[model samples]
Target: MTTGQMARAAEAPYYYVPPHSIYPIRGSLSMLATLLGAALWVNDFTVGPYLCIAGIISMLVTLYGWFGDAIGESEGGLNSKRIDVSYRWSMTWFIFSEVMFFSAFFGALWYTREVSTPWLSTLDSQTLLWPGFAGTWPNLGPAGTIAPFKTVSPFWLPTINTALLLSSAAAVTVAHHALRAANRSRTIFWLGLGILLGFAFVACQAYEYHEAYTELNLRFTSGAFGALFFMLTGFHGFHVIIGATVLSVIWWRVVRGDFTATHHFGFEGAAWYWHFVDVVWLGLYVFVYWM
Candidate 1:
């Protein structure tokens, strides 16, 4: 076939597939199970865990089957350079949307800390608009809050976690360079170290949370400060979890010889995400925790 013909043919990958199952049915069933699990988890219910487990297992199977077909198609020489470009574009847009989603939350946080508080405390004639209202950013709502706010100490484990995350990022960067140089052994070694460091960072964060809630009274119930604290760091922590998963997957793929200097989009994408997570945390460390 002509290059153009092959390109056009590859672009319509899904066009040839026969519709088999109802996505709504599958999605709804999984959602129902997950919802039950979440409800159970929230309220300490007995069946919630089972429901969630079933839902997760079913979804995993579905994903495996779906992706397996995709892999078969890909390896069968169905994809063209045009299709690769399209995939890149789609992933770019998806990541941009994610960035914007996080931006909204960041904007809300910045507004609360900078503009909202000062405006609320303004002595202008419109001060009656908030009569007896005290303006504060981190510490929001009534005199104190639902519980109370306590500053998290960054001197100990938090500091350690910070170091670990930074080091892990550094290690990943090294591994990336090693991959570029085709130094397979050094690349694997560095990637492994980065994975270990990432896990350690998570462990430290969990310990920090425990210490904050148990001893420091730093909790979500404590109005603005607590809210921003958790929302910012909590989401960042979630990204870390996702980044770790991405790296682990890449590690496995690397072992399977799925990547190389010229065809390592998966590695590059995961690396981009992990570095982004690290950059976000650096901001959180300064603005959220320290400043």
Candidate 2:
């Protein structure tokens, strides 16, 4: 290495390794409690719901403390350029994992629709094992098994949500540009708008769920279609909530002068996540709703 580069490397802040703590164990235990409670609750245990709620609360507390410490470290200027690059790589891999996660569900949907459904409806299986089974996109099991239900359409609700997510994507992009220009007020304004639109999308989705359950009779137990629908959209909604929360934290940091024109990986990381959420939603809009 060159002499000046070596000097700068030596002068750079040492990598920060947080002290060992119980947060990991605590978080794990909390998740165990949640799963245990859910298993019990499904079997009609009385204390199960309470235990689940308590577990969720504990998990939230653990996350708050854990992330709060990381935020504190970053704000204290202990995070170096090396740390920032590591964080970027970490986020990239995490998002790639999420992509594979959703791709599995999408693959299931495609396989059921295109391959399995038609394969099952062939001559032998339909005649002997199952009679009068139609090779439709959504087979309601050999008839009379699943209750009659309506599918979710890409109507006003889903379309409106599409618009909301698309708009939020634009807003966050604008906010990124503003932050790069060191325009704090403009950054905050645009970021807040993006966050607001995210929550608005969530609200509309809640209403859509209500409509689905009440009017359409679509539910988790509806059929394969129902299962895939809820699985895909529900997970996407949860991610939206997470992305908005992260962006909200970054927004607060911007307001407090935590980042500069050149140093704002926190904001960039959050924006990266938010954009990932947007892209996932578009996939859902096309495959889940319209298709």
* Per-model tally of clashing residue pairs: 2, 0
Q: After superposing candidate 1, which stretches have Cα over 4 Å from the reference?
A: 1-53, 123-132
TM-score of 2: 0.93
Q: Candidate 1 versus the native: TM-score?
A: 0.79
Per-model TM values vs. the true structure: 0.79, 0.93
The lDDT values for all models are 0.75, 0.88
lDDT of 1 by residue, 1-291 (tens): 234544565565443442475544776788788888978977988887888889878776665566556444544446666556765787678777768877777788788889877787777723566555566555546443356557886787777888999899999999899888878888888998999999888888888889889998888777777877888888888889878977987888777765566556567777878888887787778777777
The whole-model C-alpha lDDT of candidate 1 against the native structure comes to: 0.75
RMSD of each: 4.7, 3.6
Deviating ranges (above 4 Å) for candidate 2: 1-13
lDDT of 2 by residue, 57-107 (tens): 999999999988887776665666787778899999999999999999999
- Candidate 2 whole-model C-alpha lDDT, 0 to 1: 0.88
